[model samples]
Target chain A: AQTVTQSQPEMSVQEAETVTLSCTYDTSESDYYLFWYKQPPSRQMILVIRQEAYKQQNATENRFSVNFQKAAKSFSLKISDSQLGDAAMYFCAYRNSRTFGNKLVFGAGTILRVKS
Target chain B: NAGVTQTPKFRVLKTGQSMTLLCAQDMNHEYMYWYRQDPGMGLRLIHYSVGEGTTAKGEVPDGYNVSRLKKQNFLLGLESAAPSQTSVYFCASEGTGQETQYFGPGTRLLVL
Candidate 1:
């Protein structure tokens, strides 16, 4: 079974600064997909970004980018130019590309606080 | 399109009581999933449907039963509620190979 781990339970970043949330996974599959999800206080789950294991280049989405290292099985999310609106619970998820249902195995989560 | 929607935004039930959570997607997605979220425990898959008339158990499907009689709707049922089952339930759907699953707003279930 594949598992994702987010070691940091909480992280804080000052406004306009950058913060990196660490994530590691245990997967034997060579090809898979990783994602970062943000859950706000309203309980809405939003997709922050994604990375494909086969892609060497990290994925970047505006202020959100990922550092995906396949050999190390590490996928970390970096939020730059952080804003107060970035406060939320961030989750790291793993999925098998060949598997059915696209079921996601998620980490416990990291609570991100953006300080103004 | 409403994307994904779960019926009964919130509900409180007692032990032994039974209820069904309805999840509907207007995107005509081919797959649907039911998951439970608890504090400190991101989310665990309870059940999933590959398509209409096809349902399968997920990581934590023991106490949950699901039916997908319609392509656009999936229903999860708890025959008898338990306090341990008290958690926020989420429903998600995606087209085959889409790589991204759209989640519902979630149903807050409280069992006492």
Candidate 2:
């Protein structure tokens, strides 16, 4: 079984600043995928960024990037130039690529607050 | 196109009452999943379907039943509601060869 952990329950960042949310997971599978999802007050889940375990390079999507350390079993999400819209509950998820169902295992979550 | 939609955005039920939540997707996805979200718990998988008529239990399948008779539709049933079952339920679907799972708005259920 795979488990994802987000140590921080609440985080706050000033507008236009940068913020980093930490995440760690335990999995024995060599081939897997890591993802960051955002949920706003609207209650809609949105994909922020994703990283493949096999890829040594981190994944970057515009202002959102990920720091993936496979050896340490750590995957952290970084948001640059943070805005009010970035205030949401962020979740880290893991999925085994080799599995037939490809079910996602998610972390408890980190509540992000953007201060103006 | 409607990616994924869940019927009855909100509902309240008394203990021992039964109800079903419907989920539909228009992306021609091959997989569908049901999950429940609590205050501190991010989300727990309840049940999932690999294909039409093929359903499997997930991490938290107790007190929940699901049916995937049609490829695009998946229904989650609560045979006997309980206060513990009060939470937001979400439905997701993934297309073939895609790792991303599209989520629906979600259904908020409160069991009194």
Report the TM-score for the A-chain of model 2: 0.98
Residues B34-112 of candidate 1: C-alpha lDDT, one tens digit per residue: 9999989989999999999999989999878999999999999999999999999999999977988889999999999
Model 1 over residues A66-88: C-alpha lDDT tens digits?
A: 99989999999999999999999
**Residue-level lDDT for B10 in candidate 2:** 99
- List chain B TM-scores, each candidate: 0.98, 0.99
- Highest DockQ: which candidate? 1
Q: How many clashes in each structure?
A: 0, 0
The pairs that clash in candidate 1 are none
Could you tell me the TM-score of candidate 1? 0.99
Regions more than 4 Å wrong, model 1: none
* lDDT agreement with native, every candidate: 0.94, 0.95
